[model samples]
Target: MGVKSDIINFPVSSCLSPTDKSLEFDRDFRIRHYAGDVVYSVVGFIDKNKDTLFQDFKRLLYNSSNPVLKCMWPEGKLRINEVTKRPLTAATLFKNSMIMLVENLACKEPYYVRCIKPNEVKSPLLFEQERCRHQVEYLGLLENVRVRRAGFAYRQTYPRFLQRYLPHINHS
Candidate 1:
């Protein structure tokens, strides 16, 4: 906490954190992310951060009889007269949700189910080999396969190799 720098390093993932330099010098700040360092302009920062999603749409979705739709847009519950504070922006809500999810998953062994889209067309029974192959490569499924195949863990589908399971089969 004693460390001092022009840039305030913290959880930049959740919000647009203005560095000390940006605040003091009235200029843009550079964010060092996992991908790369990106310089973000402070021009119209306030306007851009404002929630742009329409209240009518929010109310429409919130008033939906479906519980899922209603639950999704809690901001819609506000009446024209009862409006006070600005509801969370879509980005803020998403960031908060992700933070909560990470907190919940921190103590648990996370299990992931990676889904690959078979085709761009979203057509059923249409398996796009190239698309699937690309997804497999991108997701490092090959690495997963290699890891699983380590230390004499060879996969076999041959006859006369059922000796280990024969006792169980005979018992059954």
Candidate 2:
């Protein structure tokens, strides 16, 4: 029998980093909890798929220097608040982005998404109390979906790459 091509074999682009203008004072990255008032502008649609959620996800997956994107793994569970009405698991977020792809591809059904540690890219600046504050406020730390068995150790396709770029974690 001949091997068949995967229907989901979509080419991905590079993940988009936040612009300097977008970076908020005192934030590491721009993230709003589900309870937050902000709409959290995930690009719904962009023709040819550029800048859209699907492309962003695909790029975030492939372009990362981190190893997690190269393979798949099981992630822990999450629970929704019901009040905020948002997903508790990072997989849920991934699945939603995939759904956008599927729907755009004219597929009626949703595909399952599994969570791995979120890609932990650097915050894009050296630590300065003031500059870093704006950067932090603009971009709070992204959550780590995959936690290592040991509290200090981390698991993913890659290890410690993000930490390499981040400012020294103050142990004091």
- Return the top candidate by TM-score: 1
Error of 1 at 54 (Å): 9.1
lDDT for each residue of candidate 2 in 1-172, tens digit (9 for 90 to 100): 2111221243333333555555443222344532243423323322223322233344455556667653321221112222233312344445545656567778444443432222234444433465444444444323222233335544333347665744667657
RMSD of each: 12.4, 21.3
Residues 46-155 of candidate 1 have per-residue lDDT tens digits of 34655656677889989999997786677788897776556556555544555556677786765668888898889998999988887888777888879877845555
**Model 2: CA > 4 A from native:** 1-37, 40-131, 141-153, 157-172
| Consecutive 10-residue window with the lowest summed lDDT within model 2 | 72-81
lDDT of 1: 0.64
